[model samples]
Target: MPGERTKYAWRSHILAERALVGAAEHAREAAELATAIEPLAGADDVVCAYVPIRGEPGDLRMLDALCVRNATVLLPVTGEPGPLSWARYEGPDSLRKARFGLLEPTTATLPPDTVATATTVLVPALAVDLRGVRLGRGAGYYDRTLGAVGDGTRLIAVVRDNELVDRLPEEPHDRRMGWAVTPGGGLRELGHELPVSPE
Candidate 1:
């Protein structure tokens, strides 16, 4: 309960800060993020990514970029609060609005454990610490989904440059990310990459 409270406080603080970013900045960051993440993708690589909504960093353009590489992109299909089911990302045309303002694929649904098939999993985050602990939007979808990931799956948290923090509140059920893909910073391995300057 204490950790959940701390995570809630951090989410509120970080979101407030994200709301201050300008549209131009978001566009630029989105482009940079697309470029940063493409190298992590390869032909036929299965990449599990989310569609951005609200002010969440790195728009679906990141997914599009991965798609351009011939990667099999899968997006979350919202269901009960647990490991998410997935669907093939057919493109921008195939997304339909789902609950909580989330966009999901309109294609056939894949099993929740489909994430185990991905070589890389890109998840939305409010903030992530240098040690790879990620703070999500209080929904336990990712925490549950990540539990099913393969041992070799590269779990990368997608966030803005500012969202990578010095530390974040973490819990026993919280899974650690292996890397973070930021706009200006590209992909940095957690706990091993040099600290990003807060300036």
Candidate 2:
């Protein structure tokens, strides 16, 4: 369980760092992320995304950008510790305060398997390494949920530029991200050509 312990330490370090980010810098990065995420999907695509909470990267504007492209966007609806259910994100008005201090869409919920319908999923992460290994909060929601996605679906982690690292502790059940989008980096492919190594 050393990897799990390392993961927790990484989470603490990253969250502490995020907590110290200045409001001006956070806003600038959020605006940049909004622009970066704007063209990610189009009218034909169904995107599974999240509304950032705490010091997570991006903001409501990022989700709005996806809507502006006419993409059908789905947001996670949390329940018990298992795969996440989903709901359509209509707009800011459609969100209601939900469990875990999250703002979830008020729309009717869909099954966890609904994520399979998405062309892209914007996963929230504390950090993502060059090998596509993502460091998430200890919850296993995404680990369980991402398995439902069909092959070739883009599992893209959303993080700040510095949050993208060279390596991270990867667990056996951990699903790898195919791409990462940062405020400054836009989008970059991961793990494709890198030599695998133990962290």
TM-scores, one per candidate = 0.92, 0.94
lDDT of 1 at 126: 90
Candidate 1 colliding pairs, count = 0
Cα lDDT tens digits, model 2, 68-102, are 99999999999999999999999999999999999
Query: Ten consecutive residues with minimal summed lDDT in candidate 2?
Result: 1-10
In model 2, residue pairs whose N, Cα or C atoms come closer than 3 Å (at least 3 residues apart or on different chains), thus clashing, are: none
Which is the leading candidate under TM-score?
2
Off by over 4 Å in 1: 1-5, 192-199
Q: What is the lDDT of candidate 2?
A: 0.93
Give one digit per residue, the lDDT tens place, for model 1 in 46-66: 999999889988887898899
lDDT score for candidate 1 against the true structure: 0.88
